[model samples]
Target: MFIMRNISIMKTFIRRRHIYIDHYDLSSTGISLNEYHQRRHSLINLIRNYIKTEQKQSSYNFTICLPSSTRLFMGPDVAYFPFKQQSDFYYLTGCMQPDALLLLNGNDETFSTNLFLSSCPMNSINDYERWYGPTITDKDKICQIFGIDSVHSIDKLNSFKIPSSSILFYNSQITDDTSTNKKNLIPFLKNFSSSIVCNQLNHFLHSLRSIKSLTEQNLIRHACQLVSKAFIKTIKNCKKNIQNEYLIHARFQYECTKLENTSMAFYPVVAANGRSNILHYQNNNQPINSDDLIMLDGGCLYKQYASDVTRFWPINGRFSSSQQQLYEILLTVQKDLIKYLNSGDKFITRGKLNILTDQYMIKYLREEFILSRTIDDDHAKRIINYLCPTSVSHHLGLDVHDCESISFSEKLESGNVITIEPGLYIPLDCTDVPSIYRGFATRLEDDVLLTDQGCEVLTSMCPKEINDLYRLLDERDNSDID
Candidate 1:
């Protein structure tokens, strides 16, 4: 039954780019480094055991692929390595180093794990290393530290021959294949005839990852706390004179990085005024006006795992009556959605609640003169699309928008973590929208974990209520700016 279910799921699984935040520093709540390392080691072992079990059914050996350096970065600068969290690689190895690979062999009743890494000389001269620092150089030292069975130069992969019974498992799309001379592992599988199968393993890893172990949950919770701190700092920095959105973004990033050796889970959405209407807006170059609403969607990662959270506030430390009303409506929808997030509930079915909430909001808008009464079902759908088009939630984990093979209709499990973000985007020039609702976009998002009872808000530390937000902003303005 499990095999059938997995096979059914694989048919619909489509890989999408996910964002994650790293917040490893927020975990210093009196925990020692040694204790953290011990916890990480246990997590690694747990992942290894699962991988070992998958390899048991086949006569072939198992190989884990790593992200190559070329794939990780686009330029010489450290910032060029576009932020991406490799979930499977992070799971088994617990190493966040980029441009490295891992291979495991378990054919002769002796299980061994081998790590392939870029040579040290490459890092000695690379600008990325100079700026970001090297993760690992000496293969022997890494093997000793991780207690892996073996270590090999990544360049030696092509020359080193594997037995005919070896089967390679990797993230089919996640790893970079740009290197001209590197051994193309996928092509090599075809040379071995029908016995070998190049299986895409990310989905299997995703399912396992969705259900966070006790330790993983604790790490995520800590990461969320750190992000909440950063959010508080950003709110404090929002002053009437300071208009640049990038300044706030930079401040948040600085706080997060300083606190936890991790970076933003993804490129932050720091939109002000009308720009906030763009759902994935990250170009924070706009000047924030005191009268404009600012929406910030971001998170931090802890040891490559992530926490994603979003909050919206007024630049002048208080929302206008209209802005407050719209913001409250979105927040209400988000709060209502949270009530339905639970085990055995289908995410798509839960999504229907979002549609219902949207319809209700539209009706309310019509009554309030924010929407046209003549708008038909088609126009209503378009209006809703403009307001809150995307599903109210998605899976969250190592990647901010983590991998899940199941469709939206699939049943939710107790351990799954997701986002409940309901928003309204009113463009400035839309004649269809009533005058009062123009030029405003409000989004209320929070990380949630499905529990036995219903759902737990992982990002509850960040204020979402209009009154609370106004108070928080006012407090920041009075104490910090002056």
Candidate 2:
């Protein structure tokens, strides 16, 4: 969930200090400029619908500030990131400028959606454009680009007086969310008139983002294709020493951004040997030993949407007997889970129980003799967490782990983009574990889009079948032969 995107740039430092960017690209594809107008109207309508159902009808105004990371301080002349518009704000306003704000006011008949541009430190209106690149300065042109009804300067945001009774529907996720990695928005609200109250609209935004629009799905699918191409390159280039963990990581980055031209969605997990057992293991510096069955978890960003996929490969172009044994069983479990998904049963639901229980994986593990016990008893079931440490699925979109507020247990809905990953971690050092499956760690992750009849595996082009992987790697090993 906390996968970091590390893109290659010509340079990102000043003479004084080095700077790291969180996200360097904010391009939007598939989503047309005209579609933003529809989104804005839908969001405002959602707000109005929410207020109408409230115990008491309330008058309110919406306020969303661009994420502070948009123009992070690096050095005197450096900015780390390329002005990534905040997800929620962009969903509603489609504006990409830094330090800007969008206000949807019900009290004013002037305009429902008002854009407030933050002035520069030296009173230069082109502050963001000066650092990022050329940007439209004409107020009307800016409005035309963003599909906003009105535009104003942030200097006048607080001056527009509102009565004490009106509420501010705020999209600042939380005052205590330290993950933003920059200043939170709560303190900035002190500038607002004390008469107005700020109520968090975080849940409303989450609910909206859970269901992907057609444009968002297309963007995510494009990212998935890029991921598949990058993965294929990594497979074809594998070597004993030259293609270690970092090589695989570099291949993914290069193929996605350099060849296909996209951005790394997160820091890739190029885990080999025992490293795969450590979930979220990102120290991609490990060697590709003769026996290491490497686990690669990498994807790229396309048009502000994310693709996440996980694959396992044997460095020597063949899986060991133990590797084959475990991979076969695990692959079956993953397929069964996916089959169930396509059967109209909610992803993690089995009548009333979560799918991770002995209901599916545990039963299969025991049937294949992979697990010592089936986790049938209460005690065995309690240890289910140890077997598969990560959840079966998660919401995926602009953020790899999108729709944080929604519980995965709920029934799957159409337009929901989620990830289905089933992984196994067996400790090699533990003598209690059977030698056949010892030190075995395998995770098969696929990005899934829930559709009307079933689901679509968006990242399917990257082959995962044991036989398929073996053939591909063998072909690659001899690709240069005459």
Candidate 3:
């Protein structure tokens, strides 16, 4: 049985500014080792239920293999990109180090856990100490920290044995493929006889990951709040006098990084003026015009959870008549979508919302896009299709688009966090849209948590209201003028 023990006997090490204690404390990450243990237990039970109900097998042994992410360099002999652990690996074991493996082996009722990590002698002048600095090589420290049955050197992985009849749960997509077969796991399992059953581990893990624990929800909520505040600062920083899109991008980055263990969740979309017509426009180097609308889609990663949001405003701190009309319409539509999600009319799902998005867009396009003329149903459909071609929402969590394998058609359950992003894009060259709306693009996004009571908009603190956005920039503009 795996039990927490005193860490007095474990060794400690330090490299540069980081310290490795005998006991690994994960409090800063806002998740507990006990939660990780429960995750593993849940996965095991999930597998067990599958075998009993679907397979109808009385007895079976199974091994689940999860490998830590490996480091990758930018180019030949260059510095590596920041190391990001595979989400599923981090989910099961709170071990944050690279080049490690976790194995859960046992029969239907119980299992034993083993963690394999790269190790070097404590006092030796080996590669670990010379080039990379100190690593956690102490087995007892790791065992107690991660609540595993035992820890061993990764080099000994091939020597370990499991029941020949054991079902093997492994997903190569989630493991480091750059590693060799012996080190990577998919090939290591091949060493066993063909009688060893192979299963796609992602199936079980994604099902579990789709639901957010209260701890996870808090992490995401914090991330959303951070991004919301950062957006306000970014808008204020760039108002009136800012010249280029990259300056806006840099300002947002600076604001986000002021907090520890936080960074942009993805390369932000900082589109100015006509560039906004291109959805996913990340080449944030174009010069901003005084009267042009600036569209920003960005988020932050707090701990490992992600929050996504999008907002649009006039670069001059005041929207033009056309920009104001289009922005107000889209903002209203986005708010209505969020309200519909929480309406509890029926069991809702992303798939249904996706379909409803088109309907809603068409309705708005016909009723509001043109004040001088009323568009018929066929004309409105054509205009909506040409202007907006993206889905309204997707699930959000560890990865920006978390649980992608989980179908959008699946019901929206409590403890699930998702984003509602409705966007409108009108290219200058496209004649389908009215001339006044041409070359304008904008999206309003918010992270939402589905609870039994109702859906909570996690990013509401981020100002998406037209008047609020105006006030933020107007105050900055006034201060600069004074």
Candidate 4:
């Protein structure tokens, strides 16, 4: 999927291919040479609009500094975690390397993107190249490959004297300071120009990122589909009541990797029984007891896009009488909430979801004699959170929890992909809680894509229906008998 083109501006030029590793898929990422150009152009328009609309200036000239991965780590320095490009930087340049900077020059005459890279090691010049490896250091070749206007040495960035009153945008975390590892601009502001203006590119960039392009949708859909298959298989494996949480977690990883060279979006939460009461349970070491209700919170990443789907099921292949009652309530609330996510629907904020869910659940609890009939509105809401400690929905995409630049009451749009998760958790030691509902937790989550007509449940095939869960175990039993 990644290959350097033969021809370049330099006649018969050779690229240093050994040290340069490109794992990113351009087609899947909706990132290409053309896409980069379009993005650069779009930002140019955004700047122009900002200058005219807000600043009331003719135009706001600026230069953006986007640093690449430092590949730096704590402790062992064996690169403990895999190297991933900073999200906003990758979104703009799509360059995968260590110690590189993308400077987007936004001037009146020219809106050109420039690349600055650290020197690559060579065997003849240094011993590090022989032991460490060869990297892409060729200036012309780097330009040709990455589709940038100009390329320079990393040291040139150090000597980058900003123009007086120049707006230098740094792509770093949205902190009060403008420094994220290599792209520190504090020294530039303090030492160099007193009048130089600094700002973060977070909000401006997120505005574009929040909306998924066609290519992004395809990648996300593929990720969700793969995760769905893996989750179904993992659930079926648990029905025998012989597997531990780690085994199920391992099974999910194995299935995702075997199907397609994919990776986990985040660590799997194969919490069984009372362990499900804890929201972020990473320790999947417990055994699956026959009567336990297991919460399988797992997802996989395919080509950088992420998929998150969770299910609550019984180890014995059948929900207990108490489990069925609570599970049905959660399942019903989740299904009902989906109706409000359609395009033009009053934005399904966390607050709105909480209000609606609490009303429904409190009413159900009262009718079923689960909660005290004397329970007031506030207490009933607390009961709802007791079972489901997490929010009903969150944006899902490149990150498992994606596009945070959204308000809780933000209107639902066509391109948005969000998760609808309504869960119920009951701890074992809580005597205050009714005995029937204690010591079990169940959370059902699915990724939904908002469409013009309604919404498309991307992970719909994963099968949350009560019948589907039972049928899966039934099929497994039938297969074993054969």
Candidate 5:
């Protein structure tokens, strides 16, 4: 059945490969021709196996979607061309360079993979090639490299006949702008068969991605270490002269860029003083006051996987008595919460762990005179709500938020990557709080993986202890003065 489909598809090269050796220059670290090939091969096998496993239950055809052309300004002069599929393209072709598409047809008996990409301009002097560099225009070479049965220019999509019983799996979220051309091509396939379904492919792909195979885990672990080293460098570089939060953010980025496997997983949150209260703060534009507590929440992307972490420090190398008290409370809550995140444990509510942690924090606050009263009814409710706005943990993987939709009562499995973050926000204007507790906000965040026995903290390289943070800050300041 697969062989017949391939014959029917007629794999022909409509686009020629125009290899410009200069294209490699666009890569800051130069292109790894070998890595690209290896990734494609790895993905092909993984997908084949997935299809085989699925075929046992039912017969369905699989199609992968790619991101379409969208302009990304690398600089004022250089722009990046778009691609069709994201993970699908990356998995099948290992082609990071965009504006490509892929289709895989698998029946219960056989399967064939096809690559559809943009054609190279016939004119040699095309400005896009000169400005942006060469792309894979040759269908033959791509077919040879990826071992796909056939390759064709995207223009041939309309002529192709899709099997009626075939299942078309593509990203449901492909935007009109990114997939306008592909959307036109979909109608042609439907003409051949009414069985075409734009099933959600990302769910299956994300599930596979969330569980770190040995190779994937190593890549993420390397990224974690790079971020840890960058954090250390950023701390050491901190001095009295650098007041601009943007400057500090740049420093962290500079350090990460030096490492091969490191870059910000997401925008760094360099919030100082009260701004730390805003959970996803990315406007690192505030001035860093000597007396303010600075919160640095950032991570590095390792081989496309992510590592998320957060650390807090006093700008002047010493936390005041009030700051120290609040910081300790947050740290203690995080530590205790982590102890309960064991494998197979089921949480009854979405934020049950966070709620419990907040309860402990409220008790500490009342006992330490941070809160005037420990009234179990209104006071306790207010304390819990103020300290933790969201759940203490969330699924974390390739994307920072990761992708498990399973909710409370679902038992945590061993391979899940999650973040444990507990925070307390104290507003300066609040008249209800004691003077010592006002204007102080603190949060401790770390990424961890659930193991069979317990859990392992992937981002624990950064210090979280109140004493350790102060000591490191003081050491940095003292070294700077010398």
Candidate 6:
């Protein structure tokens, strides 16, 4: 169920027969053009409310400008990375082309959204289109697809008019200051007076993005499900008992990509043995030791939504005593954090969740390791902090670390997606614990969605319990022997 549209250059408007994607579908992403319009409408209402409350202005005009990412080259005419649209721009307009700009002009309660796209050269053999294929350039077609008010060629932006006194809401951080794309959009901003009240749009945009719509929630759920299945497949592959970090990483990628419309969200951390002690270790080239525990922190993107998950398992399909002990402690800490969030009376923010996790980690560590009672609460906290220096939770969505502009102090409400990860890294040379635990690290991470009823773990399909993990490996071993 895909819509195929024919796009053509000016010279061969009638002769061209190449087809291009008009929009995404349920198989890829279920987001529709109307949803994009709704997002822009929400932004307009947010700005209007701010004007009424803060400025107390009966009526006012405003212009919000957002820019898309630019194409980057690695060497001579070779693009280094794939073109991913800027998140904020894609959220409002659903337009993924680079070097585009979105302009929202409004007065009182009504607003008009405009998209400025770069037009291709009008020659016989379009080099860009010849190599990369035709893009949606027709103004009417784009307006119909994105549900914007009007569409204009990017060159005309310099002449586009806006009220000089209108409030300017633009996020400077959306693109690099040195980028040519950003520089191109600067002239459009000059139309507004210097005295115009300038506000950062990311804070408001992120506030809306923090609460996922029903469609967004489903997309993220699908993303999490894909990653979970991929993890299981990778774990089973370890039955061979001769896999390396690189092979495990490749196995996970192959499993995820074999599915429809899925890609890795980020470079995975495939750490083995002492390498697990280094947080965010991504040099996935070391050989696996039969006695060493493996830590894999990887996830994939279904559509544009991302899933971030981490799991620890033994390379030999059985956990050692020390490995089991450390893994159980971390797993308990992760479970407690989720359980507390679900059962707690007061709404909890990320900061509060982090503090609670620290408390749980210290309590478990002290009880299991038999730390001296003489250690004060602050001392225990410091020790836990030293062990796991990364944040316990972060917002997850379009980007793995989604909605960065939204502060962690904000209370998590229904429809919000965040990761619950708690880990401990004990150095090989450390004297703080028994030698068996040293040089070992264990972590359990899951994608969670906050809801009115309770928090749901989206990555629950992947087994974390020791018994369940053992069952998976046992099956693998039995099958290999058979």
True-structure RMSD, every candidate: 11.7, 8.7, 6.6, 6.6, 7.6, 5.6
Tens-digit lDDT track of model 2 for 1-482: 22332222212212112111112222344566767777666656666666666624655554433333245657987776534556777777655566666666663222366777654432233444466455455677666666677777565655654444455566454444443222324444554545344355756777788788887888888888889878877777776555468877877677778744477787889888879888878989877777678888888887678899999988877887777877877788778777877776644432232454245666766666655673455654544556667776778887777867676556667888888787878777745347777788878888988898888999888899977787778778565421
TM-score of candidate 2 relative to the true fold:
0.83
Q: Can you give the lDDT of residue 210 in candidate 1?
A: 74
Better of 1 and 5 by TM-score: 5
Winner on lDDT between 5 and 6 is 6
Model 5 lDDT tens row, 1-482: 99987755553222233322113222232224454445444444455566667555355555444444333566985654322225444543444544556666655556566767655534342444666566444556656555567876576676766665655565656644444356655654455356545456665555555555555556666777788878877887777557889988988888777788455677889998689878778899988777777788888876666787788887787877788888888888788778777534654333576667777777777777777674665777775686567677777755677665445434456677778888888777766568777777767888877777778887778777766665676677555421
* TM-score, every prediction: 0.77, 0.83, 0.89, 0.85, 0.79, 0.91
lDDT of 5 at 304: 60
lDDT per residue for candidate 4 within 183-221, as digits (tens), equals 443444343344334465666766677677777787889
State the lDDT at 293 in candidate 5.
Answer: 75
lDDT of 1 by residue, 306-371 (tens): 888889888887777887777767776666566555434544344565666677677667766677
Worst 10 residues of 4 by lDDT: 9-18
Estimate, for each residue in 1-482, the C-alpha lDDT of model 3 and write its tens digit: 12323332232332221323222466766888789889999999998887788777879888888887765678976846555777888899877767778888989777999987754434333444666664554567767877899887676677788876777778857544774324546556775546545457887888899899999999999999999988888887776768899998988888887876698789899998779777778899998878878888998899988999998888777888878877777887888888887787568989887777777777666576452246566776666777778888888998898988788778888999999888888888877666887788888899999998779999999998878987898778544311
lDDT of each: 0.66, 0.67, 0.78, 0.70, 0.65, 0.79
Q: Which residue pairs does candidate 4 place in steric collision?
A: 387-424, 387-425
| For model 5, the run of ten residues with the poorest summed lDDT | 20-29
Off by over 4 Å in 4: 1-30, 72-77, 121-135, 171-186, 189-198, 343-351, 429-432, 477-482
- The reply for model 6, stretches above 4 Å from the true place, is 1-28, 121-127, 477-482
- Total backbone collisions, model 4: 2
